[model samples]
Target: MRDRPQSDTRERIITAADRLFREIGYQKTTVADIARTLGMSPANVYRFFSSKKAINEAVTARCTAEIRMRLEAVAASGRPAAERMRALLLTAHQSVLELGVTDAKMQEMIAVAMAESWGVIRAHIEEVDAIITRVLRDGVASGEFVPSDPEVTGPCIRAAMMRFCHPGLLTQCHDIPRPTVEQQADFILSALGHHARS
Candidate 1:
């Protein structure tokens, strides 16, 4: 029971860190800022996380977990390969929009994650790609899809989806409707040589 409070505090700290990193960005958000956001003292915050970098890592883990959860859901749906791929891409794109990109702080955290937390980011990418690869491979094996190297195709598909999902990239392509999650999924399917289902 005593451990429950500690766990709650830790969760609160992580949540605060995630929000602040998205709002102000990792580079500018201080430990104090997170502490204040949590209505706690800096020292109390330190008890939860030793440094801003640590908090940033926690935030990254949380974000990666969220992504994995969504990907897993699509994979478990037992849909056709094209449908699964579309679901995966659209879900990812919606996540980006829901998370929003207007926060300079969040952008900084992502930038830092790309550079400093490459291992963590790479692991997340691999996890997501693995799901897509499995779907593609399963489709081929079941004679639902053409034979292809999933190892290569998965990453390429992910790259294309990422470009469409990225905040920076989306902003640049603002002319596009930004589409609903379903629409984005259909678009990805179309791009991958699959006809969109009615």
Candidate 2:
């Protein structure tokens, strides 16, 4: 029960920061602004978050949590491995685009978050890779895909789709044409000696 208020205070700070980030670019939003919006002193906000960086990390984590949830859902599904992989890739790409691509303000916020909260971002990527590795391991067990090292292949797969899955890459490649999701999935499945679903 003691933890509840602390949790709520953190949530309130995050909520205020998120609003400020959206209204004003992250570069322009300060800790004081967040505190002011919350009707609290900057010192009070600091009591909850050690610094602006910590607040940024918390906000960034919240943003990426959406994508992680989507990927976890696809990974946990009863669908075939190839199908799940395909869905996971598509879902991840879509989530990145939704969170950072279409909105200019959001893109700026994401770029800052990526730079400021790199450790958090890297951990999120590893979490995502673990989920993919699980699907690949299951695929091998089911004979749906060729026997290969999921631990090795997961990062490779992520690399190949980085342009689609990475927020910065998504924005960078916006005006450029790239392989469709089906095409990429097919290429991966064929490389693994399995037929990709249509």
| Top model number, TM-score | 2
Candidate 2: 10-residue stretch with minimal lDDT:
97-106
Candidate 2: tens digits of C-alpha lDDT, residues 139-190:
8899988898888999888887887877676777778765876577678778
lDDT of 1 by residue, 1-198 (tens): 466998799889999888877767677778889889889999998898888877777777788788779878988897887767777787777777666653556666777777777788778888888988888787777766667788988887788676566667765666766665466566656655565557
Clashing pairs in 2: none
TM-score of each: 0.81, 0.91
Number of the top lDDT candidate:
2
- Backbone clashes per model, in order? 2, 0
List where candidate 2 sits over 4 angstroms from the true fold. Answer: 1-3
CA lDDT, candidate 2, residue 79: 96
